[model samples]
Each structure stands twice: as C-alpha cells, then as structure tokens.
Target chain A: MSSLQLPILWAMLCLYVGAFVLDVYQFFQSNEKVKKAAVIVTVLAVAVNGILVVLRGILIQGLPLNNGFEFGMCFALAIGIIYLILLKKFALSQIGAFIMPISIALSCWLLNLDMSVNPLNPSLRSYWLSFHVTAAVIAYGTFAISFGLAIAYLLREQGKLQKMPEAEVLDEVSYKMVFVGMPFLTIMLITGAVWAEYAWGTFWSWDPKETFALVTWLVYAIYLHIRLMRGWRGKKTAILSIIGFVAVIFTFFGVSYLLPGLHSYIS
Target chain B: MHKFLRSLASLKLAIYLLAAMAGLYAVAAVYGDMEIYSSWMFRLLMAVFWLNLFSCTVLHLPGAWRISRRKAKADFAGSGYENIAQAENCSQDEITAVLKKMGFKMDTAENEQGICIFAQKGKASLFAPHVLHLAILIIIIGAFLVSFAVSGAVICTDGQKVALPSAVAAKIGEGYEIVVEKFETVYDDQGAVDNWVTTLDLTKDGEVVASGQSMVNHPLIYKDLTIYQNSYKYHFLLSLEGVNAEADGVYSLPEDLAVDVSDDLTLIAHGLSDEEVFVHVRYKGEEQTYTLILGEPFAFKDGISMEYGGENNYTILQIKYAQGSKVVFLGFIIACLASVMFWSSRYREIYLRQAKDGAWQGRVYCKSPEIMRKMKEDFETNLRGK
Candidate 1:
C-alpha cells in the first residue's frame, strides 16, 4: 500500500514495454523464436497485472470495478485475457505488434491511477454487480480486439503486416470477435436495465449512461446487419468495426466523465 | 416506383440514417439531455429504421421461407464427394449419416444423368435474420405497452404498513398491501454504506402472499407485482424531559439536527448514531458534549434533558406490475438466440452427385468467401477422413 517502494503497476508497465518491443521486433523479422518469446513476455505481463488486480480485489473484498481506476484496470486485464485467447484460437501472425502497443499504453496509464481500494457504493451493491461488470469489461476487451483486428485488416489488405493473415481472414476473425463480444454487451445492457428496474422503479429511464450504451449497441447492431444482409466485406465492415469500437470507448470512458448520470459511481 | 421501393429498403439510406442518428446521440451526450432518446428526431429516425427493418425483414421473409422449403441443387457434373475409403461404393444410408453429421439435410431424387444426393446445412437458419428482426420489432412494441402498465412507489419506515395507492399513472387494479418488517442499512468498514435492504411482505385477503428481502439488485415478487427497494431517508425523533419530568416535550429533528426547545436550551447534533446522537448542548452560557438517545428521554439536569427515540427510517420501494415486461423479456431471449443464429457462419450448400464414371462429386458454397474456403477444407477432411 506504500506509494514509494513496490510499484506493482510500474513493473507491469515495464513488462508491457518489453512485450511491445518484442512483438514489434518479431513483426519486422519473421523470427518465430522472437514471436514465441514476445507471447511469453506478454503472458507474463498479464500474469503480473492479474496479481495486482487480484490483490486489489482481495483488499476490497470485491471485484475491482468500484471506481474509474479499478474499472480501467479491469478493462485492461480483460483485453489481455482476450488477446491471449485470440492468439490461442486463431492462427494469427505478427498482429500482436498492433495490439501490444495499446496494451502498453493502458498499462502505463494504470501507473497514474490511484489504485486505492474504495468500497462499493450503495447503488453498486447488487447481485447483478458481478454479471454487469464482467460482461462490460469483456465486451470492452473484445471491442478493443475488434479495433486492433480491423486495423490489421486494413494493413494486411494492403500487404502490410506481412506475416499476418490475409485481408479476408483478418476480416473474418474481427467479425467473429464481434460475434463473441456482442452477446456479452447485450447481456450487459439487459442486466443493467433489470438492475435499474430493481433499484430505480423503471427499467428504461434514458439516462445518459443507458442512452449512450444503446447508441453503442445500435452502432454495432447496424454493423452486424449490414455485414450479414448486404454481404459487406473488407473495407466497409472493417471501418464499421472501428467505428463501433469508438462508440464503445466513448460509452466506457467519455460518457462517464463528460455526461454523468445514475452511473456516477463509475466515474 | 421500383426505384422508390429500392430507396425505401436501401442499405445506403439505412447507413446514412444510422450515422445521422449516431450524430444525434453525440449531440445528446454533449448537451446532457437524455430526453433526446424520446425526441422527435430520434423518434423519426427510429420510425425510418423500423420501417427499414420491417421492409427488410418482410421483404426477405418470403425468400428465406422459400429457401427453407425448397430443394437444394448441387452439380455432379464436375465435382462431388470422391475421396472417402468407401465413398464411391458407400450405400445411400452411409452417405446420409455422414451428411447429417456434417449438418446437412440429405435428399435423393432421380435425374436425367443419375440419382442425385443433395445435402443442405444452415439454410434454414438463414431465415433467422428475419425472425431476429421480427423479435426486435416485437420488443419495441412491448416497450410501448410498458407505458400503460401499473407502476408506483410506496415508501414506509421500519415496521410500517403501506397501502398500495390508487394510480392515476397506472391502469390495471389489484388489491394488495405491503409491510416493511425491517429496514436494514449495511455500512462498509469505513462506515460507508453498502446498500439499503428492506424486508418486505405482501398481504392479500388476510394472507401473507409473499415475504422476502429486497435490495438494490434484488426484488420481491407477488403474482405480477414486483417490489423493489428504491431509496431511503433517515428520520430522527427527539423527546425532551425535565429533570423533574414536568417540562417534557417531543420534537421531530430536522436533517441538520437543529432545534431550539427553549430560548435557553439550543440542541445541535455533531453526529448521528443508531443508539445516540453526539450533540453540543449550549446551556447556561457553557457548552458540553452529551449523548442524546433520539427517542429515549433521560434527565440531564434539574431544568431539562433529552433522549434519542427510534429513527423513522423510510425505505422507498417501487411496486410495479408491468403487463408486457414478460413479453419484453421473452423478446430479448429470442433476440439473443436469433442473433446468434443469424450472424453465425453463412448458410452452406453442399452439392453431392454421382458422376458418369461412378464417382461421387461435392462442392460447397457460402456467401462469406472466407468461410467457404474453410468449410471446403473441413469438408475435404470429412470426405477423406484425413
């Protein structure tokens, strides 16, 4: 708990930098060993970050989602876990070069966070808290993955990210990421509404948080519809995916700060 | 007219409108008026979007239905299932079994060339998109019906009975009474509150129809009625007694705990506790700290004293009976299932036919060209058992 000595998050940031450097190096050169090492280091960073979160969780006797700092760390942790899962599931190439830097930036940002444990506010003391927070963090992680993959799609389509999969494969994987993430996002919204109905007397109050959440969902919903119905591919779907993640970022970060609502606890 | 209809169902127009709506949402977020969700522009865009959804789904329903019911054609002229150990010599039942495992519907019909086997997979779920859209439409309709539902809040303190008031805001009428058996507030280690919990019961016709605890994320149910612990307020009761018990008086303390019982006796609270309030009693030109048990009167001096009475804590609860919320929930479940089905990997058409050389040929097609190639690779493995 001392601010001076063991900066756990600072160490985590160093690991992030090391992983990013290795991934970028592996991307430029077709060194399988380097790729393997980068994956290992990234995994290690994630593990260390997990220790930090777990320690925080234990200190608070709850999930690390009661404040902006906690939620941000939770979101960063989600992105790391989802990234590892993607690496395991797909025969991905050096696309980690693109995603790792974002992870690094988020991890570095964690250094600035208070990281102080705050008790759950009255509004957040619900059984749905776990489900809601879990779904939201996972959804945000997948959204970040989708954004990174879309960028990879654009680059690979133009013959960049040489070792990465072709444009079509990148697009398909990104869409699949959305497929996995969208359900969790839907669950987030549903549980949020149910929780609101439980606590606020109304299910749909059109609060700023809820409204922007709907906005984000609509953006992604439109992306899904156009991709499925119109047979959209490559550039168009990739752009929409990127746009969808932007909306997600705003819903998660921007709205909390700029447009406060019944969800000020997150802010 | 053809062009107009195309425009009405236009994907380009849909995207433009959606983007415009997104812009509107940004405006709403910036201006901080969530009422924008119910604004005219929002409603208009939604109306257009709904129309687009209706036309898109209705227009596609027949095609999907037809495809679901129709025969699948696979050319045996150039390609067929040809690589299995016993594919060429395999009986129709064996082929059918493999086709079923591969998620294909098997059928055989005599043709001019020879007997043809057509297997189809995922084609029926191709219709799921339309059904998904329909479920969304149903949910919107159900949301509209929510406006007419019976909803209101009933607030009561600990061990108080609250009657379900008549609703000018609601239509449906049912007779039930609520009682707050106890209201508990839990605080964290830092003395920060965690949540307010209300132990509630519904009595109907002299029967305890339901009884349970409700908190922020939890609710109690009785028939169609839902009781939620919405909010709370703290009330402090104060009673003063003279040391001789001759100048006794009862008073309701404000939130700031300020009261002038007499010109000479001014009571101001420094802090509140369940058992007592820490107060500064300025009397006789001096100040001293005293414990004021809010409801219980204790003699402090020959002139006056005060005691803390039980708190009149009111737990606000929303008692609602939403008629179409169940339908909304059903719609949500269906939408989740249908979205999974609709956006799943494209419907596959697997064509198997017996060629002139007594060999089986197969071809696979998918709208998602990526999935087509992958499915072909997997199908090859299925055929060769490699």
Candidate 2:
C-alpha cells in the first residue's frame, strides 16, 4: 500500500463527518450559507473518495469493485453524487441532514475494511463487472437518497424538520427517486443474470445474492405500485420507501455476511 | 363472477401478491433457495402472480389506449390547471412556435369557451406501464420454460468426443457430440490461474459443425446450447512390478486406484504430487507407504514395487441449453426500454384559452410539480414578449 493511502481515506472520512455535521446544524439554523458549505464539503469528500477508488484501480490494474471495501467506497461516492444531483434538480438540500449520514457511515465502514487489492479471480475477470456493479452502485445510491427523503417526510409529519420541504413534496421526490432507480435496478438484475449464465452456466440460480437482489427489486416494485397505481402517499409511501432501502441494505451487506453462496467470495 | 374477475384484476391484489412474494423471497434468502424456489407452492404463487399481472394488463389495455388517444378538454371547470399568465392580445403563431419549440404536439379547436390551443408531449408514455407489465409477464413465461432447461458436465482429454446427457441430446439431436480440441490453464504474472480455456468442436455425423473456445466468462455458444469450462481433473497411470496379476493402469484423482494382486496383498496409488505418487502397499494386514517417482520403481519389505506412469489432465466441460432464453432476452429489452420511458419521460399538456376582452390565459398540466414549474416558466418567458 502507498504511504499516503490510509491517511487519505481517513481524511475523506473526516470530511464526510464534517459535511454531516454541517447538514445537521443547517437543519436547526435554516442558514443557506451552511447548506451550501455542507454541499461543498460533501463534494470534496466524494471527489477524494473517487480519487482513492481510481488509485486503487490503477494499483491493482483493474476496477476497484472486487471486494467489500472497494464497493463501499464506490457506494459512498455514488450516494454523494446522487444527493448533490437531487439537491440541484429538486432544490432538496434540506434532506441532506438525513442523506449525508449514510455516506458518512459507508465511508467509516470503508476505513475499517481491508483496503488491500488482490488480483482478480478467474470468474471475476469479465466486462460485466463494470456494468453490473456500476448499475448497482447507482441504484443503491438513489434508493439511499429516497430513504432520506422518506425519513424527512415522516419527520415533517411529526412536525419536525419544519424548515425542510413539505411532506407532500418529500413524498413526491421519494417516489421520483424510485422511478429513477428502478430502471437501473432492473438493468443490474438483467446484467447479473446474463453474466451468471456465461460464468456459472445458469441464468438464475437462486443464489442468496440473486435472491436478495430480487427481494430488493420486488420491494421497490411494490412501492412503485402503491404510489402510482393505488394513489398511496405521505406516510404509507414513505414507509414503503424506507422498507425498500432496508431491503437494499440487506442485499448489499446481510446476504454477504450471513448467507454463504456462490458469491461468498465477494464478502 | 364479475366481482371475482374484478378482484383478480385489481391493483390491490397485485400489491398483495407482490408483498407476499417479497416476504417469501426474504424467507428463501434466510433459509435456503432450492428448497423454496423449486417448491410447488412457489410455482403456484408465481402462477397466481402471473395471472394477476396478465389480467391487470389486459383489463387496463383499453384504458391506456384511450389515454393515448384522448386530448385535453378546453373547459377549465374543476381542473387543477393553474393560470400562469394573462395577456390582452396573444399571437397564436408565436404561441404555436413556442409550444412546438418546447416539443409539444400541437392541436387547436374552437369551442364555446374560446379559441383553445391544446399541446401535449410524451403521450406514448401513457402506455409505458402497460408495456412494462407485459414485458414482466413475458419474462415470467420465459422463466417457466427455463425450468425445463437441461445441463450436464463431463471430463474429457484432448480430442475426446463426449456424449451429452440424454435429456440434452434429445433436444439437440443424438448425432451431435462435443469434441474437446485442446485444454490449457492460463496463468497470470502472479502465478495464479488466470483462466481455464477449453477449445471445443461440436460435431455431427463425424463432421465439425461449430468450433469455439470456452472459458470462465466466455462460453462457446451454438444455437441455444452453450459449453463452459467448468473445472479440471487429473488421472494417473501406474506401472507395477514385483507384484502379480496387475499391470500398468489408469486411475482418476479423488478416488484411490486399488489393485488386489492377491487376497492377502493389495497395491494402491493413494495420491499424486508434482513428480511423485504416494503408493500404499497392504500385505497381510500390515500397510506401508512409499513415494513412487515417475518411471522409477520403489521396492518394499516383501519386494513389492510400484512405478508412477504419468498423469493425464482432463477438462470438465459443462453443456447447457436453455429453451426460452431468447424469449427472456426479448422481454429484457422491452423491460429496459419501457422502464426508461415510464420513469424519465414526462407527459406535459399546455392548455391555452382566449378569455373575453381579447386576453389569453394558459395553464400547464403535469404530474410533477417541478416539471410543471419549468413548463410554467417556459410559458411565461416565451409569451412575455407579447
């Protein structure tokens, strides 16, 4: 490992923590300057996180998506980017108080995991690795943002986060995030299936990872139906959004640690 | 009967089935996959979900078509259309040009209210949900067909023609066989296995019909069938001397090669290493272990000896043929396109009505408040020139 790698990672983690703190403080003070500063700090953290991933990829002579730490770093960067996009497009900076913590937690997790890059195994060397894992990163990141929006909705319903966007707007934006994320999630599932067929001799083997991914997709599928078809809104849709993100979390971490399968090597 | 059909076709039932399926999958993830996914109960649930989805799609088809065909009404009564701008005199030519520039399909009609201009875009997205649901139904049918897909594996040396399983052979024809042309393991600079490559030929009637290389991520595909490099195995031949009734023979790894020279004596090739083989000599209830080097005989206490002949490396090739993969791929394409259309595309309608006293009023209709605001901004900016 390079001498500067560990300190760089720690510095990125501290910057994320700083952004998270600024977001929290902005929630109380309702200062536009604090919100802007928080976003800048988040951008800086994400940039550093992205640089670390690229450095690792260069050192390993491959994409840094082979293990938990690499994926976590990518996931954190993706979440930061998605959060910034949501803020820019929807003027949803108020939910950063809820969104920034997820990136912080992921960055902290990355710090603890083994950052050593290993040579790609025979099965891991495939072009599908980029498409499948990239889609997963974006899908999970969007769902994480939706989770934060749903939390803001619930808190607003309880007469908290008074400065945040309206509960109705939060619900709507949360639905929009799902609307955006589901396509990427579908792509992830389809590409994973195609890759598995080439690598494992089956399209759908019902491995724990595949099963949990389906579960996560189905959870979001249900959320979309209730919101779009049944006219569900506010607390009900928010709760469903939260449940879907929980499923995403389980698919990402729980299946790897608790359930050993063909993808156990990823853990 | 009508109520039952309506219930089957209802969104409520679809939501219930989806939630139930999610819960079932969660359980499967926790417990195990094969026991649940291959169960009749799971199949039955999938069948029910399929039926619900099919019925829902069929029932909603006409509605989606109607939505695609319908136009915005000129009347503003009880409509959630907020008036964006008012003008004393608005130019219809400029309005049409602006709406056209904004990508709205233009239509105009004269009603009792006024000269009404209705412009809408992304009307095709109205059917996007139907297409997505239909795509999912197609995928479900494909998955059902894939349950009958057959696969098998066989180990073969170079130029060996291995017969496929009867089930697969029946589908692909019995005259066809897999011939392993060459097999080699590629190593990276770190001395780790980079890949296992197996060049294969599909032969029919003793003539080569197809040829390709199969590796970990690159399977040789022909028609609907594929050949994958699954693994490798080692088989060793042993030369025996100073023993009776057993000569040189071939044996595979993971299983000992045992030769009973006599009732009271037996010789075994226990294991293999880079340049030596572990030979077990069992004589009258007492056993001895000795390393038998290649082409060299090692003698034991009773003058029993064994020699290592050599090893034959075999590549394990997996043959798989999925019947409905094409259908699944088709469904996948449709699903991807439909999902993008359903989510990213926005259906916007601009309603412009001329009020009394030569003034014009306009309202933008959309599901998204952000898009609606943007449309309103565009309208105000464009018509502000008037």
Candidate 3:
C-alpha cells in the first residue's frame, strides 16, 4: 500500500460514518438539509473509494478487485453509487438510514483487512475473471441496497419508521433493485462458467462458491416470481428480499471463509 | 388431469419449488458435499422443477403471445392502466400525431364509442420473461447432457508424448495423443509463478492435428475436447549407489518414505533443499540425520551409500469432452442477452379514446412511475400544442 492510500481510506471511512450519522439525523428530524448533506458525504466517500481502487490498480498494474480488501472497497463504492441513484431517481432518502451503515461497516471492514497487493493467481489472470467479478460487485451491491430497503419496508410496516417511504414504494424499489440486479448476477454466473470451462475444464463443478451463488440467485428468483406473478407484496416480499440478500452475503463472505472449494483462494 | 396441469403450471408452485431448491442448494453448499448435486433425490427435484417451469411457460405462452400481438383495446376506461390522463378538444388525428411525436408506434381502431389510438413502446420486452424461462430450460438440458461428459487427467514431462486416457479416448475417439513439446513455469518480476505453460501438439494417426500453448485460463480446444493446464508438481528422487546399491530405488521424497536398508539399517527420505535431500538413517540402534547432496554420496555402512538423484517436473493436464457445451454456451448467451433486454427494456402502452364531447380520455400502462408521469406529461403537452 502506498503512503497516500491509507490516509485516503481513513478519510473515506470517516466520510461514510459521517454520511450515516447525517442520514440518521435526517431520519429523526426530517431535515432535507441533513439529507442533502448525507448524500454529499456519501458521494465524496464513493469518489474516494473509486480513487483508492484506481490507485491500487495502478500500484498493482491490474484491477484492484483481485483481493478481499480491494473488492470490499469496490463493493462499498458500488453501494454508494446505487444509493445515490435511488435517492435521485426515486426520492428514496429514507432508506439511506439503513444503507449508509452498511457502507460504513464495509469501509471499517476494508480498513481492517490487508492492504498489500499480491501477485494475481494464474487461474484468475483472465479477461473473463474481470467481467465476472465486476458483475458480482454490481449485483451484490444492488442486493445490499435491496436488503436495506427491505428492512425499511419491514420497519414501516410495523409503523416504527413513520417518516420513511410508504411500504408500497419501498417494496417496489426493492423489487426494482432486484430487477436490475438479477441480470448482472446472471452475467456473473455465465462469465464465471466460461472462465471455469477454460481453467478447470468444467463449467459447473458444484463448488461451494458456485452452489451458494446459485442459491442466492434462486432466492431472488423466488422473490421476483412471488412479487411479479402472484402480486405478493409488502412484508412478505420484503422479508424474502432480506433473505435473498442474506444469501448474497453468505455467498460473498461466508463461502470464502468456511467452505473449501475452487474459490477458496478468494479468502 | 386439467387440475394436475394447473397445479404444475401454478406460479405459486414455481415459487415454492424455487424456494425448496434454494434450501437444498444451501444445504449442499454448506455440507461441502458435491455428491449432492448428482444424487438421485437432487436429480428428481431438478426434474420436477424443470417440469414445473415448462408447464408454467406452456400455460403462459398463449396469453403472452396474445398480449404481444394484440392491438390497442378500444375500451379506454376499462383498459386497466394505472395512470390515466385527460386531454381537451383533441381530434383523433391530433392524438395520433402527438403519440407519434412522443415516439410511440401508433395503431388506431375505431369503435361505437369513438376512435381508440393505441401507442406502444418496447413491444419486444413483452416476451422477455419467456425468453429468460426458455433460456434456463435450455441451460438445464445442457447441464443434463454434460453429466455424461468424459473427462480425465494425464501428467506429462517435457518432450513426453502420451495418448489420451482410455476412458476419455473411448468417448471422444481413439488414435489421439498429446505431445508435450515443452513445459515451463513462467515467473513474474516478483519471482512468483505467473503461469505454467505447456506447449503441446495434438496428434491423430501419427499426424499433427493441432498445436498450441495451454496455460492456466487458456485451454487448448480440439474439436469437442479441451485440454487444460491443471497443475504441476516436482518429484525429488533419492538414489542409493554403491556395493550395497541393491537397495537403490526411486521414491517420491520430502514425504516420509521408510525403506528397509538391510533390515536393521533403515533409510527414510525426510526433507528437501535446493542442494541436498535430507534423510533419517536408523543404524545399529541409533538414529542419524544426513543431508545427501547431488554428486556426493553419503556412506552409511559397509559400502552402502545414498545420494540426491535430482528433481523431475511434470505438468498435469485435464482433458474433457462435454457434449452439450455448445448448447450450454448458446443458453448462456441467450440468457445474458435476455437479462439485458428484460432489465433495460420497459414496455409502455397508451390507450387513448377521443370522447364525443371532443375531450380525450387516455390510460398509460407503465411499471415505472417516473416514466409513466413523463409520458403522461408529454402527452398532455403535445395534445395542448395540437
């Protein structure tokens, strides 16, 4: 890690925390100014996260997505970008109260992880891997946002999050996020299979990572079907969406740590 | 029978099966048992899931097709559009012109009530869900076909030529062999291995058929079969040379291999270094450690000696012939394209009717509120201008 990198990470971490605090203040007081400030802080944190990724990439002479820390930072950046887009397009600032904390947690997690860049594994040195991981970052990032929106929906359903967006809007936004994310997740799975066929001679090996990813996909698939085809909405779909994101989380982190498989190197 | 088909075609059943499958996948993943994927129960579940998806798709197909083909419904009030707008004093031609100006493909139908102008965008997106479903079924079929694929691995040293394993050859074909012309470990500037590259030739009937360098992430494809550079290993051999050289043997070393050297005196290859092979010698009730370097013999007793016999490198190549890979690839391509279409394309419709009072009532069907609002605003603006 470079000298400038650590300081920038620290600054970004602080910015994320600041953004979360601001969002929380806005939630309690219903202040538009605080909401705007939280979005601005989040934008800065995301920008810094991008800079960190670029700097790490330059230092390593490759994408910074090859390791947990770099990918976590990239994931945080994706979350921030998606959150801002939801806020801008859907006027969903209330969900930021749930989202910014996740960004902060990821930032803190990144800070604790090893910052040094290592040589890329021979198996991971492919253009397909870049596409696969990039798609995963986007898909997982949107799922994270949906997770937050689901929580907000549940809270508002219980009448606790009185100032938040209506349960219907939250449900719709969560569904929309999944709608946008499923394709990226599909891309991730396809690109991964293509890469595996080249490197491992088998497209689907039932590796724990692959299985967990498929499970996550299945969960979201269920969410989409129930909500779209059956017209099921509100707390049921919200809970299902939350479960889907939990599956995503497990697929991302738990699989790497607990299960030994083709993707064990990721841990 | 109809009820059974309906049950199979039920969306609720699809959701339940998906949820169950997700649970099974999670269990299989957490249990770290890949055998679960190939188990009979799992296969049965997959078959049922596929059947359900097929039934659902079949049941929904006619409705989807009709929706895709049907022109604008004449009943604007009963059109079931969520966003409704009113435009004053607009002629049927004016509404058509405004809708056309707003980038809608116009289709007009006249009825007893009035003229109904049906404007639509992203019509192809109406079939996006079916595309996704069909793509997944194709993928599942491909996966099923791949279950019978033939695969095997062979290790080859530099300059060694080896035929495909009988198990793989019997399926792919016979008379095919791979010649490892060269094998080298390429290292980056940091001295870490960047790749294990094997330059090889695929030969059939003693004639060269294909030649390429197969490295990690870069497999050599030959017709239906592909060869991958899976892994590499080095064997440190321990050689004994002398009068008692009858105990000489080639053993994979750095792994504790105990050899009975004349019963009482035993030799165990214990470790390895660049210059020497470490061994434990138990002789005459005493254990002694010795480092036997290349070209330097260690005399144990009565002319018995041991030396490092050097290291041999071999590259492990995995050869696979998946029959349904092309089908699977096609499914993947269709799936990715359909996903893009499903997410990026937003189908919108305008059901418009000019009332006898010269006022127009219209309904907009769009999932996105912002887009629907914009379309309605644009329609009203365009109508007022007209």
Candidate 4:
C-alpha cells in the first residue's frame, strides 16, 4: 500500500469512530445541548464518510462498489443519509447511536481487506451493473432505517426506551419507509435479472445472490401485505419488519461472501 | 357477485399467497439450484395472486377513485367521523382558510344548523395503492410474455459468415446474412482487457443493408433483431504442410470444437497442460485420445501429421427478437413513477360543523396527527393571536 492511501482511508474510519463515541456519550448525557452536539458530530462524520465514498469512486473510476470495503462504505453512506432523513420524522439521535456502531464495524472489517484498486472484472462490466448496485444501495439504505425504526418500536412498546417517538408512530413510519423503499428493491431485482440475462444467458440464474434477493423481497412484501389486516399491528408488524431487514442484511452482506455467485465481484 | 367478489378480493388471500411465495423462495434459496419461479406450483401461486390483485383492483379502484374525486365536505354528517377538534367562535371561512393552509382542498355546504366546511388533502394518494397493484400486474404480464418469446443463440468463429439462428433471415422473402468480419480485444495500458468488439456486416438481397460494431452493452440492431456480442472462445490453430491435404492446411480446434483431419477422421484439441497437449480423435464411431508435446507432431492412422500452430478467438453472439421487452420496460417505468407518487404523499380530510351550543367544531382525520397539530397551532396563532 502507498504511504498516503492508509491515511486517506483511515481518515474515514477515524471520523466514523469519532462520531460513534460521541453518540455513545450522548446516550448517558441528558443535556439537550450535548445531544445536539452529538447529532452535529454524527452529521459531520457522515459528511466525511460521503466524501470518502465519493473520493474512492473518483479514484476507482466508478462508484466505490467494486470490492467489499468500498461497497460497505457506499452502503454506510446510504444508511447515513437515510438516518438523516429519518431524523426529520423521529427523535432519532438515539437511533443513530444504535446504527453507527454497525456502520463502524462493517467499514472497519472491509477496510482491513485489500484496499488497493484493481481492474474491474469483465463480468462486472455492464451498464445494468451500475443500475443494479445503485438501486441495491438505496433499497438497503431505506431497509436500514426501517430496521432501526422497528427496533425503536419494539423497545418503546416494551417500555425499555424513553424519549423516542411513540411505538405506534415508529411502527407506522417504519412501514412507510418500507413502502417507499420497496420499489427500489423491485427495480434492483428487475435490473439484476436483465443484467443476468445479458451476461449469464438467463434472467434468473437460481444463483444464491438472486435467490436471497428474492427472499428479501418476499419478506418485505409479506410485511406490507399483513399490514393491511386489522389485528396485525404493534408487535407483529414490528417483528416482521425486523425479520424483513434481517433478510435485507443477509441479502446485502451475507450472500456475496457466504454464497458466492456471479455477484461475488461486489464482495 | 357480492359473495364472490368478497371472497376473491380478500387481503387474507393476498397475504397467504405472498407467504406461500416466500416459502417457495426460501426453499429455492436453500436448495441453491432449483428455480422457484419456473415451477408449476409457484406459477399457480402467482396466477392466484394475480387473480387476487386483479379482483382487489376491480373491487376497490372505483371506490378509491370516487373518494379521490369527491369534493371536500365540511360536515361530519356525511362521513360519520366524530369531531376530533372544535374551533369554537371561528367563522367557517376562517376554518376553510386554516385547512387550506394545511394543504386541503376546501369546500363548504350550507346545512340547516349552519355552514359546514370540509377540506381534503392528498386525494391523489388514494389512487396509489390501486395503481401500484395495476403496475405490478402489467409488469408480471410483460415478464410472462418476454419469457416465452422467441430467442436463439448463434456461435460463430472470427471471419465467419452465419445467419442468425433465431431471427428469421428472410423478411418477406429477402434473405440476409451476418458476417463477423473481425473480433478484436482492446486492452488497457495495464494489459487487462478493457472491452471486446465485433465488427459485423449485414447483407440483404446481395446488397449491404447495415453494418457496425457490437460489444457487451452496445448491441447491433438490424431490422427486428438485436445481436449481442455475448462471449468469446479461443481455438489453437494447427497448420498443415501440404496444400491439398486436410493435415497440410490450417485448422482451428478447441476442446469443444471438432476439425476434420480427413473425410472420416476428426481432431479436437483438449488443452495444453504440464508440457503436454491433448487432442481427442475419433474415426468410424471409435473415440481415442492422443497426447503431443508443444512443437511436436502427432502421426494419425492416414499418415497425416498434425501440428499445433497457434490460436484464434471466436465471438459468441445471441440474436433475439424480444417483442414483449418494450412492454416490460414500460411497466417498470410506470411502477417506479406510481410508487414514488403513492408513498410520498398521504390523504387527509378535515370536517367543520356547528354544535348545539351555536359553536363551530372541526375535526381532522389523517395518517399524521403531528401535521394536524401543527396546523391547529398555526390556526390558533393566526386567529386568536396566541
């Protein structure tokens, strides 16, 4: 590795870690001013993270999505942006405290991988790949927020947390997040299928990545479907939302490495 | 009709179908090679889901459209919602102005008791759910059509002239042929391949009609067909010494491709490994394998010596006539647009009426009570100077 590359990559890691520390401190600090400071610091870290992802993209000549660490950063940036959007709807500084640790852990693990830029694989060469990854990022981002909100809903329902949005409000907002994000997931599947048809000679390859993606979609589809029923509110909806996000996590992180396929390039 | 519609349009049925799909997909993912979607059970499930969606749309869309199209009501008498709020001593016009500020379309009706004002916001949101289902139906239909569409793959070596296997070569009796004039691999400065391009020529009725280059993303469009440069294969060429002999001429061979050594004998190159090259030879329905080192000649039954000269690459092209793909794209575009429109907004209604004490009361019904509260505060701050 070059002398400058480590520092440049570590700069993003430091900022994420710094924001995570401040968020943890805010959990114990009841002072609203300190809470606001934590939010501000988290926002700064997310900004720096954004720059890191964009700068890596510029360095790599495409989106920072060709490798594991770069994709984690890209996904982290999406989650960061989605968290910020949710801050408008909920008092979610605490939620950020819950979410940033995951961000740091993933970025840390991926950053420890081979950080050098490499030539893009021939199979990864396609306009549909760009669309597929971009949509996957956005969809996973919203799913991330829905995850946080679902947890918040559960905790508040059990009276285990305080000063967040009401459990009902959190449940509804989480549903809304999924409702808004499901189309992106749909687009991701469609574009990936189309790309597979171009590259692999079939639209659905029954590959692990494609299958898990469909599994994730089915989970969210079930989440939305059961939401229409009168009795399936509160804990049922919250638990289902969490399950859906778990499927999202499995689809995004697990499938690439644990179940290798044509999409192993992303990992 | 009522009983049948009720049974067909059940949300429980939809949820059950979705759950079944989820189960099928889980099984497929765990099993790893079985395609869940192509199975008859999954297709049956999907067909039933389609019926549910269609029936749901048919049963509910007109009512949704009517709810979206109706004028906002100021009186709770029409809808039977209890008064969630009361702006006592506020004029009907003042209340209408407040609801308008809250993004409601305002209307008022003069009842026997007093003037009642009603306002609505996000009437367009009522159409979103129905539109989403309809778009999904269209997309599924399009995908179904495209799945069964006629498509074929054609493999051609470099400098070979071949007709597209799938696309009809003769359009109204005019014959056409594609000549892959050259297939070149472009490499970046690092020596990694950047992209491969295939130069193509389309001749129809003894005249050159269309010709261009095609790559992965850039496909060649000729008439009703799109020819994609899908993949490439490498073949090691064997040079012959004699001009009129099959073994004395140049022939390209890969493990999968066979070359005629004579009329009855064939030579197929297996691969080169461990300083040894392998080629499979077959004559008169008898298969035999021979090993030859690099720069060595192999003697066959007819006394023909075969030499591994060099290698050549061939491009694989897939010719497709996707008549229903455009419909799929259209469905995708519609689904995306309608989903964004549907989820981004919400429907809200406000009703204002006079109570028995000669005081006006208004109620707000919305998915968001916070927005309603903010609007109420704004109205109070505007009117009562709070």
Q: Which candidate's lDDT is highest? A: 3
Residue B98 in candidate 4 has what lDDT?
Answer: 63
For every model in order, the TM-score on chain A comes to 0.93, 0.96, 0.96, 0.91
lDDT of 4 by residue, A1-267 (tens): 234446655776776777777766765775787777767776777887787776777777777766677777778888888887777656666676667766777677766778777887666777787788888888888888788778878888888767655777788778878887887898888888777756654566578778888888888888877775444678888888888888887776788767777777766
TM-score of each: 0.86, 0.87, 0.86, 0.80
Across A142-248, the per-residue lDDT of candidate 2 in tens digits comes to 99989999999999999987888878888888888888899899989988988997898888888888888999899899888877767788998899899999989
Candidate 4, B10: how far from true, in Å? 1.0
Error of 2 at A128 (Å): 1.7
Better of 2 and 3 by DockQ: 3
**Cα RMSD of predicted structure 1:** 4.0
What docking grade applies to model 1?
Answer: medium
lDDT of 1 by residue, B220-266 (tens): 86656777777777666667777234435665554556667666676
Question: What tens-digit string does per-residue lDDT give for candidate 2 at B1-386?
Answer: 65666788888888888889888988877988578877888989999999898888888878868756666566645355445453445577878887887788887877666677888888768877888889899999888888888988888987788888777898888888888888877889987779999888888888888998999999988888888889986555665555454533443433375667667766666545657777777889998777778887666655656667766568998888788888888888888788778764688777887644546667778876778888888777776764
Q: Residue B360 deviation, candidate 3, in Å?
A: 5.1
lDDT per residue, candidate 1, A42-79, as tens digits?
A: 89989987988887777777777767777777788888
In the range B205-296, model 3's lDDT, one tens digit per residue, is 98999999999999899888889998877555666655355555655553465767666667776445556667888887999888888777
Clashing pairs in 2: none
Between prediction 2 and prediction 4, the one with superior lDDT is: 2
Q: Compare the candidates by DockQ and give the number of the best one.
A: 3
- Determine the TM-score of chain B of model 4: 0.70
Separate DockQ for every predicted complex: 0.52, 0.68, 0.73, 0.38
